[model samples]
Target: MSSGLPAGVDLTNTLLILGGVGLVTLLLRALPFAAMRYFRESALVAWLGIAMPAGVMTVLVMYTLVNSTENPGGIGAALIAVVATAALHLWRRSATMSILFGTVIYMLLVNLVF
Candidate 1:
């Protein structure tokens, strides 16, 4: 009988490696929360928290526009999504709503229309 192993690798060894990786990932993810509980946020951190979202959104829009410019439909779809996102954000002042609407429009365009 064959060992309980993959085609080329031992299953037990692979599972041990996977378990170690999973544990390390879990610990790393928890580290930020643990540290936050112990330390107060600095002014720089607070400012970044407030400003980074808008900055990141702007970068993402620019990236999408630049990357999709090769195809006319892609450019048009991206522009429509960007405008919709901006309008939603302006009207409601909610980033969540803006991003959600924009993402939905973009996905629909790419999948069905464009």
Candidate 2:
């Protein structure tokens, strides 16, 4: 009976590998919750919690700007989307709405306007 798997790739080995991966994934997922109590009051953790969002957003914007230059008219659309995203975020203070609207505007510009 052909199991449709590759040669020498038996079910037992596959099951073992999957089990090991599942165990590792569970350990990694639980590690953060386990260590949170120890780092709960740490100043560095608090600082990261506050600064990471802006730092990540800045990196994403820079990456977008850099990549947009590759397309014929992507830079202008990217800039307009970025401005609209910033304005929306500033005015509404909702990250979800700002990001969603920014993505919609960028898609529209790239597909239809640009």
Candidate 3:
């Protein structure tokens, strides 16, 4: 115990505190899914489930492209990734494949190509 301290913090207490924090974080993350399950039949919930992904993705794409101008890559990496994503999605009609290919292309360009 420190000077005048009632009880000193030790490994046990520290681990307990961290575990409580982790549990809280897990519950917080799961809250949205719990709500979704409870509101599955609500029209607003159904609309958001269908529309939120595209809306969020569009915002992310815009953010990345807008931020790419500050670097020396001439926006090539971002542009290539965008094109790859669009092309793959258009050709295969699969969001997962499009996003995967786009991410790979961006990483390759940033690490090796440009």
Which candidate gets the maximum TM-score versus the true structure? Answer: 2
Q: Clashes in model 1: which pairs?
A: none
- TM-score for all models, in order of appearance: 0.82, 0.85, 0.77
What is the lDDT for 106 in model 1?
A: 89
CA lDDT scores, all candidates in order: 0.87, 0.92, 0.84
* Overall local distance difference test of candidate 1: 0.87
What's the ranking of the predictions by lDDT, best on top? 2, 1, 3
The reply for model 2, stretches above 4 Å from the true place, is 1-4
Model 2 clashing residue pairs (backbone): none
lDDT by residue for model 3 (1-114), tens: 344424665767777999999999999999998887778789988899889989988998898799888754549899989998999899999888888888888888878887
* Cα misplacement distance, residue 55 of candidate 2 (Å): 1.0
Q: What TM-score would candidate 1 get against the native? A: 0.82
Number of the candidate with higher TM-score, 2 or 3: 2
Which of candidates 1 and 2 is the stronger one according to TM-score? 2
**Worst 10-residue stretch by lDDT in candidate 1?**
37-46
